[model samples]
Target: MIACDNLTKRFGHFTAVDHVSFAVAKGSIFGFLGPNGSGKSTVIRMLCGLLSPSDGHARIAGFDVAREPAAIKPLIGYMSQKFSLYDELTAHENLNFYGRLYGLRGAALRRRYDELVGLTHLAPYLNRRAALLSGGWRQRLAMACSLIHQPSVLFLDEPTAGIDPVARRELWDLLFEFSSQGMTLFVTTHYMDEAERCSQVGYIHLSKLVVCGEPDDLKQLPVVNPPDTRRIDVTCEHVTVGLQAVRQLPGVRTATVFGQSMHLLVEASLSEDFIRTELARVNIPHADIRPIAPSLEDVFVALTNNRNGET
Candidate 1:
């Protein structure tokens, strides 16, 4: 339902999105991942017809985003990062205002308002001013307003940013329900776990698309799983110290601290004894080492490093 062909965006001498291309199937949840200032939001703006692409084009549900913006506007809904809500307006008022903006009047507006309130469970806070609502409540209000018109596609830019874990999970549950009902979703997030849950994910770096595919397919990329090397997880005390020790080893390709453990990419010839002995020398005597698969994070880090080497 979404397609981009060499979509490029530039501002004077700086390029924000560079010839990026990808496609999102209908009812699919597509996760766009990247670091801050990686042009993730820029691409979303272009796709939503809020910004024009410098070269190439993007289409939504068969309508060109740039050329046929009017036709595409009613077909998509957008929930910005800031939860764009007026502080003085109550939640109920906000919904009614947006519904009217979408041209829903009288019976249709009332029906959509009721449905959104039920879907988001904003009944209790409907009469409360937007400024008084908590971050999670504000997010629900924003999403409800966006869906007031029942658009076929939804674009959410970091929809879970700053929200609590429970709220984040709840939001994803709602998204799943929407996707099940055949609404295409385009979401940008920095959370690796969230990216893993997507049907397809695209990683962007330095204004370029580094990779795009299913999470499992991305993990299988040769660049992520190098020849003659394997990944291992080390559960030990002082993970930072363990990471420093293993990263300096001759055959250890890379080591990154993950929570209370460390994940290391090392040559297949490097045995557990070798790693154990090294950690022992550094006062980390007890270490649990086990073979592990590359995670979505591992895929992105590997691809980003490769891209860095190329430039």
Candidate 2:
């Protein structure tokens, strides 16, 4: 249960979060996405009661963020992009420390630590120093420490950054497990795939919330792809060099590299044959060119481009 009522935050003359408003239902994962400096972390700080809002307000689990900052602190757990755990401390030691900070001790502390160890698959790394653990394992240790107090809500800012794909998936599994248990999770991520997994998503752009909705709803938004345009996926050689050349093609709306392939938003009237000819003209070799569904990235990109046009 989280609610924001026109929340705004400013620093000197610059506004970091601009009149943002959204509600996150209980037992759901709300993904926050934006480019760097888009105020994603700023909003999270205000919601967590770590940073005061310049105008308006937010309530975390019914507690007013500005009025009850202290009460809000114990009800939520926050993990940032970097590992907050001590590099010299072992996984178990980190958990024990945080547990003690939360006033947990004796049998209760031991039990909570044990539960986290198992839940995060940290039993094998219980004695491993945080510095020695891989990026993913270190993040897992940080997560276990954050949950030492069993907060009702969790705020993760770029939690999967710099971690491998497998590790990122594993982390999401744990987050989903938390959601199933009625824990409210607010996560900020750049990975479109991770955003797709969220029950709800809010896209922030230029310090404003541009769009917030279910993944499918956002994809289906008419603003994402114009009526006269459609996206095509192409697996081509020399992808790095082809991107520049492809963008210059007539009737090509936009072209961006997607993993090992390229996603081109082209005029709908342009046939696949025309696209092939254009690529051939530029000496860009490709094996396949086909239409695909709008992805989460597509929604955000369109929203961003539209926002730019409006301004």
The best candidate by lDDT is 1
- lDDT tens readout by residue for model 1, 145-236: 99999999999999999999999999999999999999999999989999999999999999999999999999999999999999999999
Candidate 2: residue 189 Cα off by (Å)? 1.2
Name the regions of candidate 2 deviating beyond 4 angstroms: none
Which sections of candidate 1 miss by over 4 Å?
A: none
- TM-score for each predicted model, relative to the true structure: 0.99, 0.94
Worst 10 residues of 1 by lDDT: 238-247
Candidate 1 accuracy as lDDT: 0.95
Question: Each candidate's root-mean-square deviation in Å?
Answer: 0.7, 1.7
Write candidate 2's Cα lDDT for 1-311 as tens digits: 89999999999999999999999999999999999999999999888887999999899989999999888888899998797889888877888899998899899998888888889888888888888999999999999888889999999999999999999999999999999999999999998889999999999998999999899999989898789999999888887677787788788888889887898888888788877777677787564888998899988888888889899
